[model samples]
Target: MSLPDMRFRAEQHLRRQLDFQHVRTHGRRHDCGAFMLWYARQAAPIAPVAAVPAASTDAVSPDGATPAETAPRSRSHQKKSASGPIPARVGVVASKSAVGNAVQRARAKRRLREAFRQHQLRVPAGYDLLLVARSSLNRLEYREIERRFADACLKIFPAAKA
Candidate 1:
């Protein structure tokens, strides 16, 4: 059965939530390995920060701005999933080199992808993500991987509380 929906946007205020496996849960694939965090909101992309001169004039009065203009706009589909900004990614470290074989790698990647698909909602709409396989992964059973992966997902994407 589906556990529940938890996403990054669902929890952005807490500081401690930005670490690896700070949260826990389970997935269908191998136990979760760990999670890496990222953010899509760029303070400065192509524009140089230094060039951002101080406002030449007093800011527009709040009364002048329209209500609709103040509302948060819906994100485009590209920024919704893989296309969107990836705030978090995960990596599965194999425990031993013996587990690094091609067959093992495929198994691990499959497990990772499977886990991701099962809980894609944990991730926010905008965020870049990459899952790496580690050597420590070989020793753990798939269930363990699932648990770890779930934890990582929660860390990246927290669930909405009722």
Candidate 2:
């Protein structure tokens, strides 16, 4: 698949430290044992970043912003995707301390991403969600994690279901 075909759109990622901080400070937090889910509604649309393939760029950083995300690069060669940004901006975190070794952390993150993508539309637009992985993430089954995520979205973002 082409880069744009697999586009996870830069705007849908919580690419700035300040964005993560804002959600943590002002958003509501829900502990699902497997992960901590943080939700905040954006006041208005933040300026959309140029379309870039997420897989080619950065990993989750300590400050939450990767150098790729922070650095301003030329948009001259970039082709804008026909689609606009989705309402939900999501950040997924898996700490070595909380989630264990590299392999385990990766698995947790992978599961979390799959769970979110499967239930993406369940979350309304303009809402930011941060998913921080816990130790339990690896222990639980993928279905269980998915169920928890869906349940959380259903309860918190019921507008989608309505």
Candidate 3:
């Protein structure tokens, strides 16, 4: 049987410097054997847009005014509402002080990313997560690393609410 697409997309990652700083400053942290997990619940999902009728040229405003009479919504507001909820994002930090040379650091990141990608569905939505690698991470096998990550996620996010 063909497995489902599980590729990690850029949108799924915690990319912004501000996001990282926010998590660092305010998120709760959990220490697994090989790494530290930092997480925080994000804001509520955006309100879904109302469906527009294809045949209607003139849309009625919510306040009982014509479309032209109503003030146009800002572009940023439209974009924010269109994009919907931000999914659980993950950021991996493998510093030189913890994970040795560049190659090792990259390897650690790759392994962590893979583990997160495979088990991301189990993790609850709407959390910003940061995983900081430790020196001991290099010694563990990939399976062990994945197991550690899964355990950490379970501890950090106990019940996966629908």
Name the candidate that leads on TM-score.
Answer: 3
What is candidate 3's lDDT per residue for 50-98, written digit by digit as tens? 4444345576667877654554443331123246555677999999998
Which candidate wins on lDDT? Answer: 2
List ranges where model 1 is wrong by over 4 Å.
Answer: 1-99, 159-162
Worst 10 residues of 1 by lDDT: 39-48
Every candidate's lDDT: 0.45, 0.78, 0.77
Tell me the spans in candidate 2 whose CA falls farther than 4 Å from its real position: 1-8, 43-86
| lDDT, residue 11, model 2 | 65
- Compose the digit string of candidate 1's lDDT tens values, residues 18-105: 2223222212232233422222321111322232322534444368754444445543321323444433333333333535677877
TM-score to native of every candidate shown = 0.41, 0.69, 0.71
Question: In every candidate, how many clashes are there?
Answer: 36, 2, 0
User: Which is the winner by TM-score between candidate 1 and candidate 3?
Assistant: 3
**Clash-forming residue pairs, model 3:** none
Error of 2 at 159 (Å): 1.4
Q: Flag clash pairs in model 2.
A: 87-125, 87-126
Q: Which stretches of candidate 3 lie over 4 Å from their true place?
A: 1-5, 43-84
